[model samples]
Target: MEVGSTRSWDELLPDALGLIFKNLPLQELLTVVPTVCKSWGKAVMGPYCWQEIDIEEWSNRSEPGSVERMLRMLIARSNGSIHKLCVSGLQNEPVFSLIAENARSLRILCLPQSNMSDSIVEKIAGSLSMITFLDLSYCYKISARSLEAIGKNCKLLEGLRRNMHPLIMEERLSQDNEEAHAIATTMPNLKRLETAYLRYINTIGALEIIHSCPQLEYLDLRGCWQVKLDGEYLKDKFPKLKVLGPYVVDRYERNNDYEDWSDFSDSLYDYESSDDENRFGELEFRFYQQFNEDATNGWPPSP
Candidate 1:
């Protein structure tokens, strides 16, 4: 292979092009890459390339109808082989139903910052039995019943993220006493979990989760102000676990007392100094990477 040699990418086989398409993030593959040429379009538009469909970034940036049409098109192209899907802001139920109807092999599903209901959860659970990872963070409408449905149906589920808006968290501080118990009892296979901004969960619930899910490797209870933990006790209880949030504040912060008590609507501009901002940046980056790691892997689309 000479450095100066001119090779024609147009001459590359369909399988080679499919491999290249497989490596790209779904956004790029759908919008930018396919427009290169007819041959490239033909390769990239194959169902193998549509295995992982992530359009979370398009949330609020485009109209719901437009997103739905795009999704429908991709669903058609996927030919029922979609393994991972992330659509954060598209709140149309018919489109969601279409996704459930088409993407039977879906392993990971993410719908953060979207409207969700018990019926929707039941719909998804009823269709996709192979789901292992699910993210419904910032979905304020979902209740404990929804969680129970997923736990009951998606027996293979290993990772769950269900952080809520801080205002809603405050409202449900007293109401969600039994929710954690539901999780601990039903979802025994859970390995990774993020229940951030949940003021309802108490020490009892947290302990229950730690004790029940022996396979738990990662847990994020950030902004869960009520749940208290003795670090050593947690360390002893779950030897394989790496727990994040207030419990590990001493390890990450200069002043462990300086808590990140934020409302869901506000940005980090309210922070007093750049140091505080920087700390939050690091924390957010770390959490985001972990949150998407499984989906962002070559196999699944990152939500």
Candidate 2:
């Protein structure tokens, strides 16, 4: 109320500062905000700011091994109170184990494009009992076995995204509906299921899921060329359910937001065919190259 009054931002409480810091990017939170003042630094270092850690953007642009190190640091800062975590490009086993050990309150976990395997899924199922939403899109290594384990363990789960790349002609012929059956039998509580771009599932699998998961409110079957839906049947049986029909090439051609063929522009997707045994090797090479370039130029500026 005075003409010459001065306000000190550093005097703000840690909880208030944390609410403000939550809006900032992970990179800025880690590097810029902390250096402003002692109070800001303390707030950034506390568990409040690390409750919902989303490193997807930073992980995509950062150097190799940097994402893992940053995850370790941030998870430690959270002090086991992390509730939602979204990460990409993870290939390490120990990091999954670390999350299982520490993040007991985790409810939403997104690991899109990560190299997670079925064994790892089994290992972490026990720790994921509290999870409500999970995203495993583009995780080709995961199978029906892992989905069974997840459904059994994560009783509270209501959302699942298990999207995949469209299968080649030969692979599609031999593909089974085991995954759909697993989801249908075990994950009855799911309300939202996204199985986009999965060429393996047919009408049988789709019917199985629709019949089993009676609570489903939203179902996405885009790019599933084999699954043919009867519109009248769906409307009569499940009037409240909303579904996205199979992919129509011309429909998504003008829509950039659709992820059906979004990754095809990347070099990695160029080798995504079943015959490409060295795909991971190439990915590692690219990661290492990027890291070397960043190190030489002093990227991230030591924070």
Query: Quick one: best lDDT, which candidate?
Result: 2
In candidate 1, how many Å is residue 222 off? 0.9
Writing each residue's lDDT as its tens digit, candidate 2 over 1-303 gives 599987788988888888889999877988999899999999999998998888876787775499899999989999999888988778888988988887589988888777789999999999999988888877778889999999999998888887654432225546789999999999998887878667678899999999999888777775677788886788789876766646332221111112232122333221113333233233211121223454323211100
Give each model's whole-structure lDDT: 0.67, 0.74
lDDT of 1 by residue, 1-303 (tens): 789988688778876887678778767787788799887888787786777777766644676677778888878888898888877666767877887788578887877776668788877777767888888877777777888888898888888887654444556766755768878987999887778666688788888988888787767666676677776766565566766553322212111110111112122222123344445433432222213444322211111
Per-candidate clashes, comma-separated: 0, 1
- Model 1, residue 118: C-alpha shift (Å): 0.9
Model 2 poorest 10 in a row by lDDT: 250-259
In terms of lDDT, model 2 sits at 0.74
Q: All candidates' TM-scores?
A: 0.76, 0.79
Q: Which stretches in model 2 have alpha-carbon errors above 4 Å?
A: 1-7, 167-173, 250-303
TM-score of 1: 0.76
Top of the candidates by TM-score: 2
